[model samples]
Target: MELSLHIILEKPTAGVAFGLQKGSGNKYETVQIQQTDSGNLDFYLTVTTKGDRLKDALPRFGGPFIQGPYMGNFIYLDIGTLAGQVSPWNRRLKIPMAGITWEIIDQLSADVALMLKTNVAGTAKDGSPNCATVKPFNGWRVVSK
Candidate 1:
């Protein structure tokens, strides 16, 4: 079953937060980002399947697509295909920015959990950074908190 997922990250900052919202040990300190009234950056991502299920009785079709920064990366989509399926399903997700660079972030799948929660570690090209921790701020679903 090919499906898409909507991933969301909340309350992103630099040198603060953990898990998936950590910034590059302040490396992204100067990175440009839009802030909300409550002081949070939101990222939006959309992923889609590549083919339909019922082909013209041709060979089965469908597969996974991956693209983005390596190591400590964030994925927004997760595409799944059966042994011989045709059509594919899709999901949408919105993530929060942890001061990471746009060039470093990539979208791979569409079914990945709308990780309303995550960390923002620095990019590899930017060099290693100190360990950062992250967690939900209000202990609520990404939509509520």
Candidate 2:
């Protein structure tokens, strides 16, 4: 089964918190977001498996998985370049001077998790029992902070 989640940010600086339930028992995971000192956003992931069913299924489903924003594929845009392209008459173009929004961060996190899960499943199908730690196809864009 494939799952996707979308979280709207309440504010530009506000963090995001969500949970991902796995297996048929009390196994679950938490994904938390926080701002770093360098003006970058970071994620803290924690997985918990308390049932025997979940522990047994860990080999196939791959448990104890954690990830951050830098572990996924994303696109970045340069605010200055974007603003420069706008016509002088159209002064309504307001550029964001702050860091990235939580929406983008949440989407990136979901995308990374999905990719990791899919890769692990595919590897298992190919007769590999271990979870696959595949690198993301690309990295986020470096925007001016």
Candidate 3:
């Protein structure tokens, strides 16, 4: 059997969609997407900083500085019926950031996907957000080159 899944992370605007101004402060810099597994788009979103400025600033900020990109986890559930009763397929996956995890939720001709929400520390509210429909580069196409 062959099964594959695709996941995309999108912002609420066209500019954010293009990664123009996503990071906060001067820490924001260009990052290369490092792939761990291309089959599921598993990768890392990282950024680089110049000089020891970040190092010196850490003391002032009173905390240890962690560089980008932070990884996240993914969880899956399967809702099935047994003996005319509903049952759950308890499944959990530690899907690192830029990773995808999938499992058959049901045997019927139905599609299943999971949506997760992580509370983002708010940045400057400069523009309106595309909260209604936030999508990846191609609506769901997550990988490019």
Off by over 4 Å in 2: 1-15, 18-26, 31-38, 44-61, 66-145
State the weakest 10-residue window (summed lDDT) of model 2: 88-97
TM per prediction = 0.23, 0.18, 0.17
Task: Return the top candidate by lDDT.
Answer: 1
Write model 3 residue lDDT over 19-83, tens digit each, in one string. 11223345443222212111222222222212233343211111112223323212111111211
How do the candidates rank by TM-score, highest first? 1, 2, 3
User: Local error of candidate 1 at 64, Å?
Assistant: 14
Clashing pairs in 2: none
Stretches of model 1 off by over 4 angstroms after superposition: 1-7, 14-33, 36-39, 51-145
Question: What is the clash count for each candidate, in the order shown?
Answer: 35, 0, 1
Question: lDDT: which is higher, 2 or 3?
Answer: 2
Across 16-134, the per-residue lDDT of candidate 1 in tens digits comes to: 32221122322222112232223343333332333223542211212222222332223321111111112232211212223322211222223244323333322122332222222
